[model samples]
Target: MKKQLGNNYYNIISEDLDGEIYDLLLTDVNAALFDYSDHHKSNKLPLKSKFKQFLINRLFVGFYLLNKLKKRYTGEMIILSNAYIPLNVPNSVTLLPPWIFSPKKKSFANWKIILIINQLKFILKERSIKLLLSENFKFLVDKFELELGNLFVKFKLSAVVVPNDMAFFEKLALRVAKKKDIPSFVCLHGLPARYNDIDDNRADYLIVWGKGIKELYIDAGVKEDKILTFKHPVYSSFSALELQSNLSNVLVLSRATCGIPCESSQLILTDRSTTLHYTELVKENLKKLGVNKATLRLHPSENEDFYLKNLPDDFFTIDRSSKDDALNQCSLVIGPTSTMVLDAIKMGKNYILFDPVFNGLTLEGMPLVSPFTGESFIKLSNSLEEMKYNINNPNDNISYHELNNFLSIDSNDEEKFLGIMNKNK
Candidate 1:
């Protein structure tokens, strides 16, 4: 069963641990995820590891850890992921990272530094059987280089390909896989964007959505023989159509732009959540200027007390987690970066992505960064008059041109992915 990887993080989470305490905490978490109603008592993990002896390692932790452990224990060995994973073992592998990715440069830098060191160690230590998991289902470009490096490495047929990522993450994975020299494949789930870069550096084989993705890869760079458009392992078929949308009708998406859930890195992004606060202020200013009746969707876990105490009664909040209600109701979606935007599109709703793109540290517990532009709505003034006018024409004020042909996949994603993987296999 899938589970959460709490306690492992010691920053904004908690620092309660000893030397071997990491495993202990993990056991506790796993037990909770597995529904610990009865079975208790465990000094060490019931299952042991191939190398670490303790069965768990910091390298593979979080939601990802559960899947790896499931594989080792021969317990259900099912794909436990936020996205699709490999159906088989050794030949198929997951490609997403075990930890949350930060958009901030400092996190990227630390990751780069640590990765470079790891690469150096891999070279020096000769631990070449490297398998990279799928994508983060959100940030497609976040770890492109790392995946590319993994694909480039020479090993025993390299790592197996698993269905990784859901939406954009899968798209990014496909692009990177396109770069690989080996026979590569990804099972279908949501049809992510087919990056032109992917076709240029196409994998030997691919599991794709349907004729559309197949045609896309062929256009991008994939040889016809390398591409396989699978009948979805999940859905039957799908179609895409654009919805007429407006801006004044606000799309309230979940955003954790507050400062409380801080990123672990102290170097930069220490105060990255200032944008959320700033956004709040900007909204207030807009309201004072006279614009009212915008949707304010709070992140699922966000504390509304501060905003409740400050903002006027005009503001209205809704459940961002409820995918159906928001898409079917709101006009234009707005937030830092969230899956809800994509979810909105899938539901035939228009959206405007708001991304501040922090330079330093990006906090944990925050949502993924939106892939859209920050200045898209700059022309709209904070004045009530401007907001009201903009609200009256949400589509006109914001850039809707960004949501073009690529992201409009209604349901044919799974087929596209599996087609590629099955062909490669």
Candidate 2:
């Protein structure tokens, strides 16, 4: 079937034949397999149709293979996206079906399917064009354990693609990939170990934080061989920036404790989705307390208008130029758990970890599924206040050696991981 589709003598397909062809394409796994030159003249689509086609295309699961086949030669990659294009893209990208994506409907994860496909469609144009999927194929339809047969089918995919680990796509893709024998990659963004996704079968490739994260994965069940690590792409240049020294006295982040060896001087208010309007809440609460002397640093994209309208003029807002700048002026971080808490530790700053459960974990009996505990985690959340009082008092029990061991990273791991991703590298 693949050979027949690759054959040049085959009649050039037309949109008039789209429905019938789509039916035939569905019968064979290779039906939509296409070459760059064979598909003639492009067509524009209405925004609504474009979005519908996008949803259908994601379900197909054949996109990665088709995109990879195109890499046999350097050509243009065409996709459907409203986002800005990446520079140095190997192939050209364009919209095929013009449709606006809607997320309001819930057809048993139809919305989630559309979002992942749209993202891949967007990324494909910049990277190597691989394969394409039919509009309705899914790797794991439903279940935690993989259906061995479908898992094997998915293993053949050139890449096990997923948008974000939190997207539920991560758990399913990794499970399928594990059964089929392939690498599964996950991108992490500041969600704590709250999700039990640390299973050994979680994923093979992880885009996570520094060395601490790698150990976390190891502890979770991922074998060393199945893991790949890299700094978040957003933080690749973090080490290169000059550290701003003259930080302000007011901090916007949540995890901070005063009077510690690394105590913070800045007044703090961390952002949570529950308190996007925290400034207003803070103002009201402060007014009740009769206190009015604090500066506010924003949590990136909080809705300022809601709070501004309610607050008085004396309440100043800290407009951090960027995430990096926010880090500089931050006095102390306050949160239950965060990768950033470790970052603060790395920077030798003061912070307070306010875990919802202290002196214990959410998992009472199962350590594998339990939250952080023991000396390593206690340092961030439970010990900060105690350490503050004992400033200048040395304790041989403070296992700095163990802490360094846990935090240290094998720098050579990056080259090793890239070697795996790019066979020729």
Candidate 3:
């Protein structure tokens, strides 16, 4: 049977260390709201307004095409106006008919129609300017915050547990929780891109993956007491997987970008363009080592179609399978500074840390200095040849004890999480 927190606010999803029921006001970054509205579906907009909407959409598409053209030939467009043009209308406005703006059904009339049309014109103009300035998303952030605040009030939520406090919505939710005198907690899902990303003001409590992360937060100015070390729930199942000795099938994890560095002196950071470059290097090295079978696991944020089109088909198989399945099948896992490396460790797979940008450089302000310094289990490879050698000579140097220092593999993660929630309550 399901448990209840109060009348209708939240429900008791799980139990604590003392077998006590804990209420969770579950929430998420509502991504579905950002998806395009179904144009074919019937809506409250009048027939005339619908036609105007169609025209607006067409105009938006035309402007987008023009913008693409402008990007291609910036110098040649001397005759045309260089004013910014948005690629598309905001999903929030386009998803619904303008008639929906009417607070009362009877209030919808000519004035409302005029107002809606004017609003659309204004939005189009503003969006164009925002696009030009690369500030399109900044405008919507306020709307997201307002919506989140309203939801919290409507549900009479007691507390909020989010994955990352650094996210715009999560931070907003945390602020709302603070305003309401309710506790807010952020579970560290992955490593922060930079030290500055960790904001002490964002959450009341932080449930970290392990001691390593706890140390990172403390160093970033987050109070030591506010942070709690808990084993990552995802790693718990894979912790039982024994490390393979004879490494054969290799899995190369691809990242979308090497996040901005904390220090100015950190080697010139590379972008997504380096993805193919790194993958090709890995492919060449694998081929040289006589390891024909290898899979390239694209990051979740990466475009699968783009990689498939660009990457050599014969060199490596593009793995779109679940991470657990991929980890299970592969004997060796290789990647840069990614949370998946921790996952690979939990799965008892040998992983090689490869990052050309951070080579021979260390940032004192960052949690991951060189990726090589933190844990001895991770084999740091400077070049393709080095990586190939490491793979061929499969080292059994990294033990579970070393892995434990980074991640709490054997701990009851649920209990630890519950303890944090209970303590805050």
TM-score of each: 0.38, 0.42, 0.57
Model 1, residue 141: displacement in angstroms? 30
lDDT of 1 by residue, 360-381 (tens): 2222323222232234222223
* C-alpha-based local distance difference test score of model 1: 0.39
lDDT (C-alpha) at residue 80 in model 1: 16
Error of 1 at 93 (Å): 14
Put down candidate 3 lDDT per residue, 1-425, tens digits, no spaces. Answer: 12322313122222321111111111111111111222112213456767977776555434334433432212111110011111121111111112122222111113323343444344433423222222333334344445445544543444565665433334555665676666666655565545432343367776666666666666766787677665544542234345553447788887554232222212233444567777776677667767777788887655555576677676778897898999889888877677786677677677777655444432222334423543454566757666766655545434455556665532554465455334433
TM-score-based ranking, best first? 3, 2, 1
Q: Judged by lDDT against the true structure, how good is candidate 2? A: 0.37
Clashes of 2: 36
Best by TM-score: 3
Clashes of each: 40, 36, 0
